[model samples]
Target: MSKVILITGATKGFGRIWAEAFLKRGDSVIAAGRNITALEDLKNKYGDLVLPIQLDVNDRKASFEAVNKAKEHFGRIDVLINNAGYGLFGAVEETSEEEARNQMETNFFGVLWLTQAVLPIMREQKSGHIIQVSSFLGLITLPVLGLYNASKFAVEGLTETLASEVKGFGINVSLVEPNGYTTDWSGESAFQTQSLSVYDPVKAGFKAAVSAPGIFGNPEATANVILKLVDNDNPPLRLLLGSFAYPAVKKVYEERLEGFEEWKLVSEEAHGA
Candidate 1:
């Protein structure tokens, strides 16, 4: 049976790749994005397999309308992939309040609104999967990516709580933590603040690290992982994509646990035990 998959940010990068992959697998796709021309192109290429919608996920009303449109066209939405976010690069002090709020609007609040819109349909069907395309930056942090990290961290929390709340309805929520992939994520899709000399070294070093050959994983591989995840009857709450993502997140959690154990006595005494 062909499943209905709805994806935000479906005009480019991982979202586009995921949409194509699903369509190739005989699935019906509702590709939602802000670009009408790109969406039209998708429809032209995929024909009836793809229903392209002009959707700006930051607009709450638009988000709801897109979901409703998907449900109406497909009659059911089996998967909702919240992949509509951009990276905001700059030091915490360097980014302005407006920039931070814009980042939150698209990366955090956009996910919330879209998920809220889709939940009712999924609840009625009693079977659906919500996939959040977060980043490995959500687990760890980079010096200049503070704002992006904050947005993804918010998503991490939201997806986790949502998973618990919707489990009884057969809705599976999963956060896909992808490491650096060969995408426009850092190019056309990224936002950056004016550079400050104080953070130049931090910025340069981080750039060098990620730009190293073979450090970034394949975007196709990430899409493949998501397809397998959706096919499973029991999916995990979190799925880390790429070889580097799993090890990197594991290291961060290990360090966090070690640090917590070191402060166990002080933490315990805070309760006046």
Candidate 2:
């Protein structure tokens, strides 16, 4: 059966790649982005297989309206890929209140609004897949990416809770945690805050770390994995997209476990009468 997949941030990068993959496989796509013009080629090439909608995910009303429009156009939504978010680069102290709020508004609240809007539709259908494009940074932290990490961490928590809440409704929710990809995520799509001289060394070290060879993955390679995820009857709640993600997350989790063990006595005492 041909599925109807709605993808946000479908203008370029991973979103556009995945959208094209779906269209090629006969799955209809509702491509939502801020730039409708960028989507014209997809519409022309794929014809009715693709529906481009102008949307800025930060707008809650627009997000809901976009979902409604997709439903009306396709008659059903089999999957939703919430991929509309950008990276915020700055040390925690260097990040301004406005930057932090804007980061959350789009990266976190955008996901929330769209998830809320689509729930009713999926609930009616009794089956649907919701994939959130998180980051490996969601599970671990880097110096300059504090706010970005926080945003993705928020998404991780939200999606995890949502999975449990909607399990009875046959809704599948998965967070796609990818390591640094060769996308414009860190380039044109990213927002960098005012730098602080105090953190120059930290920033320099962080820059060198990210520039390491094999730290990034190819975005095109993710389409098959995504296809398999949505097609599976029992998809994972968390799917790591890049090769770097697994080992990176594993090391972080191991350290976290060690910390918990190290503080076991204190933790028990805190819970005591």
Candidate 3:
């Protein structure tokens, strides 16, 4: 069955691929983005099936307006993919307060704002799916991408709580934790901090090594997994995309568990009598 799917950051990368996949599968798409030209091109190709709406996800009012417009155009939104975010590459000390705040505003709060806007309508309908595009960094962490990790980690916590809160309303929330993909994420779309002499060696070594080709997975495969999640009646609270994502996250969890168990006696002894 065809449904009305709204995707933030639908202009490029995973969002664009997901939008295309849905449209090709006969679903209507509300392609919301900051880029007018790209959204227009999507509309031209898909015609009425694609409703290209200009949306700056950072603005609360704009998010509300976009949801309203989606309702007006498609009558109801069956799914909302919160795929709008950029990566900030820098150590915690390297990133300015403004840069950190901007990263959080766009990644964490933007998802919150848009989800808030769409929740009321979904509540009334008693059925909806909210997909948050988090990264594997949300589960683990990276050296230079600390700020990006912070934002996605915040998203992970928020979406987990949201999933529990909205289950009564028949609204499902899931986090898509993807590893590095062949996208513009680490390229033109990424933001970097001014290199400090202190961390230059660490940055130049490990970061450079991982930024090579073939390590990143394909975006289309990730999108396909998401489509399956959308169609699922009882979807998971978290879905890790790409081959690398699962094993990497699993290792993180195992290591975390080991540390916790090792410290169990010390942690328990610290509790008040």
Candidate 4:
């Protein structure tokens, strides 16, 4: 059966790749993005299989309206891929108030609004899947991506809670945590805060970390994994993409566990009578 999948940020990166993959497999796609013109080729090639909508995910009203429009046109939305977010690069002290709020507005609140908008529709259907494109940074952290990490960490908490809440309603929530990808996420799509000379060393170290060999994965390779994820009857709550993600997250958790063990006496004493 052909599914109706709504994808945000469909203008480029993983969003566009996944949209094309779904369309090629005879699924209907509501490709929502700020750059509707960029999706013209997909619209032309896929014909009615794809609907390109101009959207800035920061607008809560527009987010709800997009969901309603997709539901009306497609009769139902079987899957929603919330891939509409960008990276903010700057050290904690270097980030401005405006930059911090904007990052959360789009990356965290955008996901919240869209997820809220689709809940009623999916609840009514008694079946649907919501995929959030988080990052390996969500589970850990880095020097220059402090704000970006906070946003994804918020997403991680939100989606984990959502999965538990929606399980009984037949709504599946999955967080697609990818490590660095060879996408424009860190290039054209990224926003860099005004730099301070004090943070230059921190920024340089961050740059070198990302530029390391095998740190990034091909964005195209993710389509099949996404397709299978939605098709599976028992999907994972958190699906880590790329080779770097698992090992990286594994190391972080190991350190976290060690810290917990070291503080076990204090932790137990704090809760004691």
| Whole-model alpha-carbon lDDT for candidate 2 | 0.94
lDDT string for model 1 (106-212, tens) is 99999999999999999999999999989888889878989999999999999999999999998999998988888999999999998889888898898888887
Q: Please report how far candidate 3 places residue 12 from its true position, in Å.
A: 0.4
What lDDT would each prediction earn against the true structure?
A: 0.91, 0.94, 0.91, 0.94
lDDT of 4 at 23: 95
State residue 33's C-alpha deviation in candidate 4, in Å: 0.3
User: After superposing candidate 3, which stretches have Cα over 4 Å from the reference?
Assistant: none
| Model 4 lDDT per residue over 115-213, tens place | 999999999999999999999889999888999999999999999999999999999999999998999999999999999999988878878887898
| Deviation of model 4 at 67, angstroms | 0.6
Better of 2 and 4 by lDDT: 4
Which pairs clash (backbone N, Cα, C closer than 3 Å) in model 4? none
lDDT, residue 151, candidate 1 = 94
Model 4 quality (TM-score): 0.99
* Local accuracy of candidate 3 as per-residue lDDT tens digits, 12-68: 999999999999888999998898687776677889999988888999998999999
Summed backbone clashes in each candidate are 0, 0, 0, 0
On a 0 to 100 scale, what is the lDDT of residue 267 in model 4? Answer: 99
What are the per-model C-alpha RMSD values against the true structure? Answer: 1.1, 0.8, 1.2, 0.8
Better of 1 and 4 by TM-score: 4
Checking candidate 2 for backbone clashes, the offending pairs are none
